[model samples]
Target: MKVCLVGSSGGHLTHLYMLKPFWQDKDRFWVTFDKEDARSILKNEDVYNCYFPTNRNIKNLIKNTALAFKVLKHEKPDVIISSGAAVAVPFFYIGKIFGAKTIYIEVFDRIDKPTLTGKLVYPITDKFIVQWEEMKKVYPKAINLGSIF
Candidate 1:
């Protein structure tokens, strides 16, 4: 199955990369920011660079949504998975519209507090995974996948 993995550069990307063993067997590509970490880690991977200043950046999110539409249209991934910041919003929405299964992994940092991205994507997500078991209190249906660190 073709998979599209989306995440922000920092810890979000780190956790997603840690799952390389899981996705490597599938046809996969990445959607992330063009940062030093992403540039280095994704050097040999199929990647689509998104705009920076994400999360609360309405302008960039809108831009990234358009980019997401284009990418999902062309890639036609069977599944779209994200360890998010803000870029995941557009991709999740567009991917859903295109009938791609959506999967979301909440970042490792938040145990007590819920991420805005997580709340937004949870309802549409086919699989919602959390690193902390405590997160199940916040996301009752989330799967406890343990730490990716």
Candidate 2:
């Protein structure tokens, strides 16, 4: 199965990376910021850099939405996954139109509240994973998978 790993840089990126065991054998690519950490960690993988400063940034959001359309159409991954900041919104929404399954893992730091990205994608996500059981109250259908860290 082809997998598309999408997330912001830093912590969000690390969260998705921790799932290497699940994606290691699959045909996969990454969509993240073109930052030092992402560049270094994903050096051996196929990577696409999306527009950043995405939180509450309308311009970047529009840019990323366009980028999402282009990337999702080209990659056509079987599944799209993310532990996000904001970049995942466009990708998840667009991926759904492409008929790709989506998985959203809420960041471990958030236990009682949902991240904006999580709230945005939850409605369409095929699998919503939460690192803490308390998050289930925020996302009733979420699976409590504990910490990915």
Q: Report lDDT (CA) for all predictions.
A: 0.93, 0.95
Model 1, runs deviating above 4 Å:
none
Per-residue lDDT tens digits of candidate 2, residues 1-149? 99999999999999999999999999999999999999999999999999879999999999999999999999899999999989999999999999999999999999899999999999999999998999999999999988787
In order of listing, the candidates' clash counts read 0, 0
Cα TM-score of candidate 2:
0.98
lDDT of 1 by residue, 1-149 (tens): 99999999988899889888989899999999999999999999999999988969999999999999999999999999898989999999999999999999998889977899999999989999998989999999999989888
**Top candidate (TM-score):** 2
Best by lDDT: 2
In model 1, the Cα lDDT at residue 1 comes to 97
